[model samples]
Target chain A: MSRYLIQFAYDGGSFSGYQIQPNALTVQEELEKKLSILAQRKIEVVGSSRTDAGVHASQQFAHFDCPVPIQKDWVYRLNRMLPHALAVISIEQVADDFHARFDALSRTYHYWIVRKKTPLRRHDTYWFEAPLDLEAMNAACQILFQYIDFECFSKVKTDVFTFDCTIQKAIWTEEGDFLKFTIQANRFLRGMVRAIVGTLLEVGEGKLKPEDLHQIIQSKDRNQAGRAVPAHGLHLVEVKYK
Target chain B: MSRYLIQFAYDGGSFSGYQIQPNALTVQEELEKKLSILAQRKIEVVGSSRTDAGVHASQQFAHFDCPVPIQKDWVYRLNRMLPHALAVISIEQVADDFHARFDALSRTYHYWIVRKKTPLRRHDTYWFEAPLDLEAMNAACQILFQYIDFECFSKVKTDVFTFDCTIQKAIWTEEGDFLKFTIQANRFLRGMVRAIVGTLLEVGEGKLKPEDLHQIIQSKDRNQAGRAVPAHGLHLVEVKYK
Candidate 1:
């Protein structure tokens, strides 16, 4: 059997989530189903990230083993079978032992916020009308890299061995009427990004001081942090590998 | 009775067109249907521009006659009743004699072209991979201002009293990874903006000379013009009034 890795993008609003469930549609389920039909056999796929429902992905990776070698027309044929929301950007043959999840070095996420009522960007962006202080928000992002434990931002009941995470970069950039928050990390816990975003927004809103994030992270209490932002505004942008 | 003018926006993929017709969903029909329900009386609306199917509008206006005066909570309540793809930005009372169609002085349309497969912008932007010559396209736009009749760039079977239109502004602007064509005219013929965009793309592709547009316009024959571009990439951005 040969292992194949494919990079894809999906609109998260179309599926319940990335992982397979009993009744709801999912990205992994659709990919496995389409791949199995193409290969004429059952195929199980492993994704690098299990993004939440309504969380979009610009670049996601998955690996699967197939008895037949990679077909030249597989990407084109697979895309034709996938829905408009799910698309396979590219595919390549990888070593049999190369794991999509374990081999990933880092992952990046973006949270998009728009000011006015936008019809085109409704599904993916959060409409935030209040004035924001970007300098304060950026200052809060700096506090994230100072700590390795993000338990304050993660979901309380998640099953995880450790809450330690290395944040490589975190910054907020203003792009014409949109405010985008970008964060890159070695690893993330469930609901970590959204919770961080919501906490940072309080800083922008003048409710939480920039230095308060340090205490929140030190507290390591989920309730100590701000509320978790909506899943629709968050996106899984890139998954990096060494 | 009072005439109220509402400035709104819509994703044209949600409707067949701006006009009401048999056995088809339309923006005008939706507005009339909802307004009728809100007023508890039959309400008729007249749109400033009849946009084509699959086209989008960032800002559009429609005037409707109501038995009652403008309601304070109409905008908020109407938006709740509208679909996610449709929204009411604002509403105000206009003069009883004011005409939505005839009182409009000019209209601005934008055609967005992107060079990459943007999954987020798929519905509103045309994915064009060719290297465009903006200088050639801009030169062709300047030539448009020198002429009045645009018969060659209009649909062949359209019914209109005259084909003359006054060009106020026409130019192509590069907006960081996207090419946008903006055109404002006192009036337009059927399929005029899209046909002009398609023919200008030929100039950018080196298929047609920039000067060739002069002859094409003078031909006054629809067969002389290039094919009309897809409607999805076009947007009715503005409608000015005296």
Candidate 2:
């Protein structure tokens, strides 16, 4: 059997989520169907991460084992069969032991907020009509990197065993009329990024003090955190593997 | 009667077009309906531009006359009543003679293209899987400013009497993975910007020579020009008036 590592991209708007369901459409289901058709056999794809419904991913990694040897142009052929919103970026032969999910090292996520009232980009970006205090939000974001436990921000009844996540970097930057929060971590809990962004927006809107962020994290109570931000603003930028 | 200039924004994806059609939902229809309900009388709004279906506007200008004075906070009220994708950014009292369409000085458009093969931003930006030659595209863009008659790029069967337009600025710039073209002109014929972008993309892909752009413009034949780029990639960035 030959194992192949596939790098793909998809717009999350049309998907129920990354994982498979009984009748709902998903990125994984579509890809597996296409891969099965190309290989002339049924195939199942294992993804590195299970992104939530309405969450977008730019570069997602997956692995599949095939009975037949794969050709170099499989990437080109798969892309042709896929829809315009989903694309197969690259494909390569992987060692039999190299699993896409198990070998992943880290992941990066970006959340976008449009401060100005723009009709053109409303669907793609979260619009904040009130003036935001970016400096205050950044100050609060600095506290996030210092914490390892994010139980306060995680969704309840999550399958993940531990809430411990080492945040490598968390910073907020403004580009044009958009405020972007880029965060890197070993792994993220369910609804963690959206919860964190919502908390940060509270700081930006002067509802919560910058120093209160640490207190909320220590509270270890989901209710202590602000409301989760909308999913459309969040994007999984990249996943790293070693 | 008092005339008010309203600055609006809308995601054109849900609308048939800006103009009111017999059986189609339009931006104008939505706004007029809301305004008439609020005023307890029939109302009409004259927009500065009638954008095509699926074409978004960030800062669209419109004018409507009201017999009674309106409170400044009506802007906030109108926004709260409108859909998430449509917003009234500002409303101001204007001269009785002010015309949203005829009094316009210049309009700016922005076209977004994503060079990478990624799915996360599919609807937000145009995705071109092929590698683009930016320098060649920019070289061709320079030729756009030198042209006066843009009949070659205008849509066929348009009712506009004159094809003469002075393009004040036309340039392509790359930011991260996005290639954006910003064009400002005194006036634009229907489909002109998309046609120009389509032709310029041909130059970027090495399908057409940069010098051939001038010839395409001089030919004044819509069929000779490249295909009209998709409306989702184009945005009315700003409209200026004096």
Candidate 3:
């Protein structure tokens, strides 16, 4: 069998989620169905990140194994057949043993907080009415460097072997009317990024101090943290591989 | 009765067009429906520009006459009631005789051409695989300066008093991978911008000479010009009023 890896982007507003299910539309199912047609068989794909519903992906990856070598012009042909919400940006052949989910490097996610409301960006941006304190937000980001286990930020019923994740980068950058919160980690728990952003926004909103993040991390209690923000504001920007 | 002029922005992908039609969703109808509820009476608005289906507007205006004074908080209230594809940006009181359509001084339109395809901009941009010579396109833009009767570029069977328009500005600007064609004029005929863009593209494609535009304008034949481009790529950027 030959392993082929693909890098893609999707507007998650169109799908239920990344994983395939019985009744609803999914990114994985659409990709797998398209790939199966191209391969003339039932070809399954393993995604690197299982992003939730309404969470967009600027750069996501997946790997699939096929019995025959993939054709050269498959990228152009596959993109033509894909739905408007999904597209295949690039494709490459990897080692037979390569995996998509269990990769070697970190993943980056970005959450956009738009100050002004525009009709064009209603899908991908979260409109925040209150004035945000960027100084407090960035200050809270520094507190995240001390922790590895983010159990307080994970969903309550998530199935995970370990809550430990190596934090590489976490910062809140101001882009005009848009406040972008970017985080990079070796691995993430379910509902991690949105929860962290929701909690950090408390610091920006004056509800919580910057140092309050330290206590939240040490509590290891999901109830101690703020509620998770809406999924539409989050995007899987990149999944690095070695 | 009081006349009010309101400026708004719309995604335009969700509406059939700017004008009201039977059994079709339109920007004017939606605005009238919401405004009538806010004013507690029947309200009618005259739009400054009649954009075709799938055309966006960053700054479009309308003037309406209402029996009672509009509330101060109606902008916020109407925006909440409006669909995701449209928004009432600003509202203000105007003279009783003020008209939306006839009182406009100039209108600006932009056509976006994308060299690369991204999932987010799929609705608003036109993806062209052809290599365009922008120098030739800009030269054709200069050729438009000497002409007033653009009947060849106007859509056939269009209801218009005259094809003569005062062309104030026309240019193609390159912003990274996106080429924006901006045109400002005192008035525009139905399908004029798209046809002119289509004909100018032929010049960029090396299919037609820049000076050939003179003969096309003189001929005053709709079939003598190139085809009108798709409506999705066009945007009514601004409608100047005095």
Candidate 4:
């Protein structure tokens, strides 16, 4: 048996999510189906990130063990067989112990918000019509680094055991007409990034103070925090491994 | 009667073309249909640029005469009523003699070519797999300004009386992962911009020399030019008027 690592990108607007579902189409299901057909055997892929429906990815990694030897042109072949929204950038042999999920060093996400409505970027941006205070939002971002427990930002009734995640980097900047947020962490709980962005936006809108975030995080309750932002505006941009 | 100039943008992937057709849907048909409903009368609009099918427009202008007075908030109302692929940027009353297509001083087009395949921008850019020499392409751009007739770059079945158009600016530059071509002219023939880009790409690929364009233009034969590139990669970015 041989293990191989695959790097890919996907536009998640047409998918249900990354994980497999019984009745809905998903990124994992599509990848596994195509891989199984190519290998002439049932193949299961372990994905590095389980992005939600309507979330895009610029770079994602996965690993699978195969009984057959793979060729160098599998990237081109697999991309041809897969749907247009999913594309495999490269595939390479890896050690047997490389787990795409658990072995990942860090993950980064980007959330995009546009103040003006444009028809060209409707799917990729969240149209936030109200004026936002960027200085206040950045100040609130600084407050998030002081804690590791982000239960206030996660979705309720998830299968994960712990809500602890060590954030490596978090910053907010303006890109032309877009207000972008970038955050990196060792691991993320269900719906964590969107929830954090939604809360920060409330701070920018003057509905919440920067210090209010400390109370929200310490409360260990989802209801104490602001609402989760829409999934369409969020992107799983990068996943790093050592 | 009041003549108003309306500026808008559209993702032309969903449109057949800008002009009205008998059985197919076009940008003009959608705009007229919606405007007629809003104005409570039959409305006909003339567009500044009649972009081809699958070509995007960032800033397009149109003129329509309204019998009733329109509110200043019509931009918001028209955008809300239009489909997701179309948006109205601004609307202002113009002189009675102002025409959308006739009085335009210049028009500009932008063509995007991406060497790398990314799923997020599949619809917005042309994926040119081969290596392109930017310097060679720019050298060929300089050869275009010395010519007045671009009959070799026009569509064969067009109904234009004159093939003469003065070229103002033609340049090629790098934009992130894309090699962008921007061209401006007083007028353009059908399929002119795409053909120019295709011919320049041939020059970049080392198949044609910079001086070869002069012979093709002087030949006055459409068959002498390269093939017209895909419309999906072309965008009518700007339309200027006095």
lDDT of 4 at B33: 94
Stretches of candidate 3 exceeding 4 Å from the true structure: none
Candidate 3, B103-170: lDDT as tens digits: 99999999998776567777888877588999999999998999999899888888888999999999
Which ranges in model 1 have alpha carbons more than 4 Å from their true place? A1-7, A19-46, A62-100, A128-159, A168-177, A198-228, A240-242, B36-40, B71-73
Q: lDDT per model, in order?
A: 0.91, 0.87, 0.91, 0.90
What is every candidate's C-alpha DockQ against the true complex, given to 2 decimals? 0.42, 0.52, 0.68, 0.68
Clashes by residue pair, model 1: none
* Chain A superposition TM-score per model: 0.99, 0.96, 0.98, 0.98
Clashes of each: 0, 0, 0, 0
Q: Report the C-alpha displacement of residue A140, candidate 4, in angstroms.
A: 2.5
By summed lDDT, the worst window of 10 consecutive residues in model 1 chain B runs over B114-123
In candidate 2, position B103 carries an lDDT of: 97
Residue range A1-242, candidate 3, lDDT tens digits: 88989889999899999999999999999999999999999999999999999899999999999997787888878888999788888889898889988974989999998886677888898878687798999999988989998999999898898999998999999898798999999998999999999999988999999999989999999989888999999999989999
Ten-residue segment with the worst summed lDDT in candidate 1 chain A? A114-123
Give the per-residue lDDT of model 1 (tens digit) for A12-77. Answer: 988998999999999999999999998999999999999999899999999999997778888878
TM for every model, in the order presented, reads 0.80, 0.87, 0.94, 0.93
- Order of models, best lDDT first: 1, 3, 4, 2
Which scores greater on lDDT, model 2 or model 3?
3
TM-score of chain B of 2: 0.96
Query: In model 2, which residue pairs have backbone atoms overlapping below 3 Å?
Result: none
Docking class of 4: medium
True contacts kept of each: 0.42, 0.75, 0.57, 0.62
Better of 2 and 4 by DockQ: 4
